[model samples]
Target: MHYDVFNGDADGIIALLQLRLAEPKSAQLVTGVKRDIQLLDSLNLNSQDSLTVLDISMSSNQQGLANALQAGADVFYVDHHKAGDIPSHANLNAHIDLDAETCTALIVDALLQRRFHLWAITAAYGDNLLSKADTLALQAGLSQQQAAQLQELGTLINYNGYGEDVEDLHFHPAELFQKLLAYDDPFAVIADKHSPYYILKEAYAVDMTLAQSLVASYQDSQLSVFILPDTSSSRRVSGVYGNWLANQAPNHAHLVLTLNSQQDYTVSLRAPLTNKQGAGELCSQFASGGGREAAGGINHLPKASLELLIQSVSDYYQVTASST
Candidate 1:
């Protein structure tokens, strides 16, 4: 048996898309909403099973990976997250790059010698690696207009993954991937009018309009925080909204907090693009919070701790901003 396990975000979907397009294969697909990273836990591997894991952290799935290895599964892992110690077993192959600028799709692009380079660029854009995507698009000889179209496509696809669950999302990531796979080129998806790209684009416009009306709960020279009411719109827009805010003020950190079912807050934090460090560390100070240096979140922060979180975030940026 063969299994393909990946994160349900643009980077994971595009990474798998490039691989499958290059080497057609039949594998049981495993994926979830953007935050569902511990994918290997749900699988039952056997000695003969071949598993391909992408875009998720090995550290989060360390136990599952160990059990898979013990079961004699041959695993291929590719990621750009904070991987703890990786197993060196002959059955395990890991390609992990911690470079702040890299994403799983780009890593796959390097291995594929850019056979699907444009798709990789689209994934980079989707992952919010804007500067990198711009460089790759130009290097691929895409005209300015063509590159802009690709960026918009990437952003829409990315926006669809922000929801709390499949119920909150417009299309399940797997379904979206299947629809997208029909078109080898992202441009074709955009042209199809009936494609997921168009659906996502229309939906994204409405959500962003609602989000833009929200005023920041806290704002200063170094940090700006917005606490959104727990609505489907808030859940759907939080991640992309953070990206938009970060881009709008590259010199200031941005935090988007949404009230969750438990009456606590789900926090999304983005460090200044000018100094994309300390976000993960700052977020990690709270339980259920941690991510890459540039972006991160706290899954459940008590309302009582809101003031503490706000102060820590402000202090983190103050120190880091001065150093930068």
Candidate 2:
């Protein structure tokens, strides 16, 4: 038996779509929201069983993964997240390339070129790699308008996975994947009578409005922070709101912090487009967070350090301003 495990966002779903299209075999899917990366531990794999992990980083679940591989299951892992030190195993085949601009979708696209090219474009768009998606869409013979629609669907699907829990999301990504499979092409799915695109758009609008209305100003000239209430909706929409805030204040770095039910806060940090190189490293210093040069986040930060962290961010910005 084969089980496919993936992040339940655009990248994971599209990667699975490509794999299924290429392999055309039935396999059990293990997936959850963006936060549910530690899903491999729940699976029961034996020496003969095969598992394919997509878009989830080994660094996040190294111990569990090491145990699984040692148990003799053949694991094929593809991801773009930061991997500290990968253990060698005969049954482990890892394709991990940490290029901020290249996502797992592109990695799968490169590996299985002709079999699933279009779906790769969708995944890239979902990851907000617009230029890359557009370039690939053009190469795939899709017109400008078609590419735009595909990008919208990709972004929408990606956006749906941002919330803290399943309830906060626009639609459960696994359910969304079933809807996506109904159409051979995602464009057709978006245009279909029963398409969930309309609902997604409406929900995005409402969330964006609430995000814009809730602003937390700071003293630094190039830094802004927004603290959201502890709610499912706030947690789910925090990252999107952070990006929106970044756009709204292009000169400043935007941090979106939201408290969860447990009173622990999740933080999304985005550096200005001008200096997006070290935001990931900065976040990692405080919490279990690392990402590409431009965007990253800390999974959890205690409420006690909340005010101190905000002050540190402001001080960091001040130092940057003076240094330049």
Instruction: Please name the candidate that would achieve the greatest lDDT relative to the true structure.
Output: 1
Q: Tens digit of lDDT per residue, candidate 2, span 1-324?
A: 888888887888888777776777667878887767777888876788889899887887797688778779888899887676887888989999887678888899899865767778888887766667888888889998889888877777777887777878877877877677665567677777678788877787777677778757554677787888887667767766765666566668878888876788888888775554556667767866665555677778898877877776667766775776
Q: Compose the digit string of candidate 1's lDDT tens values, residues 86-172.
A: 988999999999877889999999999999888999999888888989999998999999999998988887777776677889988
Question: What pairs collide in candidate 2?
Answer: 163-236, 164-236
Q: What is the C-alpha lDDT of each candidate?
A: 0.88, 0.77
Stretches > 4 Å off in candidate 2: 138-144, 247-251, 311-324
The TM-score values for the models, in the order shown, are 0.97, 0.88
Off by over 4 Å in 1: none
lDDT of 1: 0.88
